[model samples]
Target: MCNEVWLTSPNSNTYAQENDDHDAKSRVFCTKEDCEETFGMFLVKETMYLPERSYSELIRSSDTIRNARFKSVNWLITAHKRMNLWAATVFLAVNYLDRFISIARCRDWKSWMFDLLSVACLSIASKFNETNGHSLHDFQVDFVDTCFAPTLIQSMELTVLKTLAWRINSITPFSYIHILAQSVDDLTKRATELLLCVVLDHEFLEFKQCVVAMSAVRCALDQCVIKTSTKNVTFGHLETFIPQDQKDGMIECRRIMAKVIARDREILIRGKKSPATALKVDLYDFRNFSADDDSFLRTPEINVGSGKKRKREEE
Candidate 1:
């Protein structure tokens, strides 16, 4: 008779012990579990990670709040590219920003405050997701004339952590992309990029993270130049994630994503520059923060990635 045994590390008090035990128990160690029950489990588990406010609710806020969010997100993207941080870092940062704002309800926030909050969010996310240490100086990139003190940034970060109740293990769309895409490397890769772009668009908040992820996978499936094997996973297999009653919502989500992608592609085709690349000629005013203090005025010392610098020199 053969016996099945679960193996655990001798140092079970380590951080990975719980994950190892959970994986052993759930039998979800593989990233590409296509079982219907596994999908159902994921769907249920993802609900807890959703933001308090939906996209519709967020958009219903005053113009000041909406514009602040949009600008802060753009700055985060710029900072992400400038610092060469991980995609997961920026995704988690945005998740924190959304959840914090929904709960904090800071409608009277100024532009510079939003900028500070954005920096704080990215800093918190980088610490959580990256092995490399990032200082507040690294986050000060892309600012025109305003620089936040480390203390201020740290304070805002603490506020976010408290508001989120220290729930830093964010389950973003990236979490489900591989499993829902059936673990195909090509499809997973493309879907991941699409989801990254989708997260930038606030419209995606209308749908659940699972739905957005599934939609990105479908979009990637359509864009696949090579036909993937469907013996194990097919379109019908993905459809099972969405019930007939909820199919319309999925379709709408996909539609929003298509428009988002189309606009993204057009921007690339037109060679439009992102905010980070645009020339900064005008000095940012600090009148909102203080009319007398000049201490906030500091030059931005942004570093260009080696690849980008080399490409630019070649051009």
Candidate 2:
């Protein structure tokens, strides 16, 4: 307990590392009992998570998006890349928006709601996680052709806030991302991209977030090998980081994600869908409101499946 500010305040951020504070240089770690108790509390809290969609419900949509959730994931990933933001913040934003849609059972996946929801959720996510918050102008410019009035954006934010009961800090796959990953490099960035994809897929709902991140890490490292790994990362190098119990799940996720990536790559090679050729979810019975408003930005005819090959923009 030398020159250390003890875990003194109840209002202190539990999320911060004790060692991050210069004052805690010689502070003793809380004993095993404390660690176990904290972990157990986390496990109990995890049980409260709402599993929004089942495998059948996800695949059996009335619309013909053979992979409805998959497309949404792709959309989110592309938007994130175009914005040049942290992958995790984008993940957190999409997590909030997707979970809200699933929980609300808003079958209107094709509605204007989601477009607005995307803007609001990303702004909120940036506020929570980023040092600098995203502005309406930032969203408007980055999402060209999809322009919303500032008032409309604010209203939608309030609606999403209420719908989610203002729980913006809900647990996400990214929380455990650091545990499975060693370093943030090209391989890890690709892994995060894969992680974002799987998290949005209802097909992978059975697996936990940790399993998804671990699988992504495995898949990304494998891609690096094929693509000429700049970091020389290998699956075996990170194997010890994964828990023994999760190895099986990680393998299954790796297989599934690889297949997904392969399919996306095929699409990219063929060129992305033109705005006129965009596909909708199977259940596109009647649009309460067109999500395809002139205000909404449709997927551009760029290389959609470009994957990690798309060079990161200089920050």
Candidate 3:
């Protein structure tokens, strides 16, 4: 399956044109009926292993990560140039790691840890450069009573340092902080994040679909944000343009930010958007060959051992 579905070079116009006829033929006939039947049988065999939910519900549930308000606040700070990209990336990485680990170990989601990690990583990275010179002790004191114990706090600090080292070694020093800051809408922000993720790690093939989907969503958000922000339109004032029925759709746009991230991961791993089937054939022809001539033609073979061979020769 991997060999059959490996990533190929982006399609060229010539290849697309060549496939146009084949695509039309596929649409006109059940070219893959056997493959489809086999897949259906396999699916039936694996029905017990399948998760019980509509794809939409699974997608929506994945979007719950966007409800994470700390991301919004972090965006705000990074937008202002108050935080460096390295700091921002490290902050986010540390926060995500802590959350993932905590969830796995404790089965609890600590939302506040995100805020604390953002602030702490930013402070530490700033101080390391001797530019900001912020007091680390103050940060420790502020979060002391929170979920972080002294030992856990030390571990978090070490984790931040290790992550920073890994990032610095792996990624170029060019900062994406400005691009992210200028993204005035959630879609734009999400798209920027996905793009940055890909840029930071090209091996993250799972993000390709999310990045494409977010690109569309971000463009929509860009239009809305520009209109609203530039025109100074408030929620109350938006009633003039936004209808009540459409309001739900507009709100759902934000949800797409989360959904794209979640759905992209799931799709890349488990789901197949379309069938993995194609018409395959091999052509064969029997032809006469004359040693003295370059051209060949189809002809019945004469068995030299049989009397019919002499008869045909005489004929």
Best by TM-score: 1
List, residue by residue over 175-210, the lDDT tens digit for candidate 1.
666566666777777887787666767788877777
Which prediction has the highest lDDT against the true structure? 1
Whole-model lDDT values for every prediction: 0.63, 0.51, 0.31
- Candidate 3 off by > 4 Å: 1-120, 124-130, 137-155, 163-165, 168-255, 258-315
Tell me the TM-score of each prediction against the true structure.
0.73, 0.60, 0.28
List model 2 lDDT by residue over 19-103, tens digit each: 2321221223245443333333333333333335442364456453324444545555665555666766777676676655554
Q: CA shift at 181, candidate 3, in angstroms?
A: 11
- In order of lDDT, best first, we have 1, 2, 3
Estimate the lDDT of model 2.
Answer: 0.51
